[model samples]
Target: MNNVKSLNKWANAHTYLPVDVLRMALGVFLFMKGVYFVSNIQYLVDLISPIEKIGGGMFLLHYIAPAHLVGGILIFFGLLTRWAIIAQLPILICAIIINFMGFMHHQNLLLALLSLGVCVFFLIYGSGKNSADYFFKMEQ
Candidate 1:
């Protein structure tokens, strides 16, 4: 759409090296989280257990880790950065909601909130100059 094109244009003009670094850091964090979930399946199970009563919880159990893994990689390389962030949005939102519904860990709540905020920022900011998306765009 026109809006997206305009936003991309704006992001490219505004982007700098530090923003690109932040995006990479975010990607690493999410990827590690995916690895954590995959390694400790039981922890992930317990994470969603309280919300099981909300329905569709089992689906989340299966969905979160893989989404994080794939989405994290896509985001790290800045390949389809917005799309990757869009995919991550639901998981991050659920993470925040889940924290409130259960035994509250301030650390987790804060981390989730911070990560969600950054994700939202990057969603608008795009990948910046030093990214696969920019490089690929140049090639085309």
Candidate 2:
């Protein structure tokens, strides 16, 4: 379809090596952060308590770790990168909200803001030429 061609063109257009490097870096950062969350379950639980009070509950708390883990891996490999980023958005947004509410440390707010910015960038530009998305798209 013409639309698919258009999308592929747009996705491949104007990609730079730096962008891909940054994307991979973001992926690593997210993956490590996710691992941190899993390793520090008590800390994660405590951090999400306020969010839990805001109707997120135990379910939200419990799922956040694995979502980050899986999403990070997907992003890292550039496999289904957009979907991975989309999946992480809800948790990231919620974190931003919670952090801004003065319930978290100032440094946490900064980290959340930075993470949100990078995620938004990748969401819009996708994975670039160095990614699995690019390889698959090329094969198509």
Candidate 3:
């Protein structure tokens, strides 16, 4: 916990505008993906259909869109960013697995990997100085 606090302090001190913008872009991408998933529910269902025998596949199905939606908003606003990204990580991991289960869609795999990478980055770097998390902490 002490190490985590020190890392966070270092990350916050080193943040830059470009990094914040990157975070915003990642958030937007996730939000748009959520919207896409919501609009094309059938596609997502079909994608995960093969995994239905796994017991909790359907349950996981219900989590994806909402996680992306809520998590994206939280990440975009830089509020509880690590928590939001943590929520997204599992979904992204499943996405990667699903992409390979049936058909190897290189594009989808690439996108998932990229998103996962960004999420991992934010998970460590935090919301930075321009984030709502920082703002609220400062107020307190």
Maximum-lDDT candidate: 3
Candidates ranked, most accurate by lDDT first: 3, 1, 2
lDDT of 2: 0.80
lDDT of 2 at 137: 70
RMSD of each candidate relative to the true structure: 0.9, 2.1, 1.1
Q: What residue runs in model 1 are displaced by over 4 Å at the alpha carbon?
A: none
| TM-scores of the candidates in the order shown | 0.96, 0.88, 0.95
| TM-score-better candidate, 2 vs 3 | 3
lDDT of 2 by residue, 66-129 (tens): 8888888888888888789888888888888877664768888788788889998878777777
lDDT of 1 by residue, 25-78 (tens): 999899999999999999998888878988997789789998899888988889
Whose TM-score is higher: candidate 1's or candidate 2's? 1
Candidate 2: misplaced stretches above 4 Å?
1-8
Which candidate model has the greater lDDT, 2 or 3?
3
- lDDT score for residue 26 of model 2: 76
lDDT of 3 by residue, 1-140 (tens): 88768877998889999999999998999999899989999988887875778888767778999899999999999998999999999889988988878788899899999999999998989989999999998899
**C-alpha RMSD of candidate 1:** 0.9
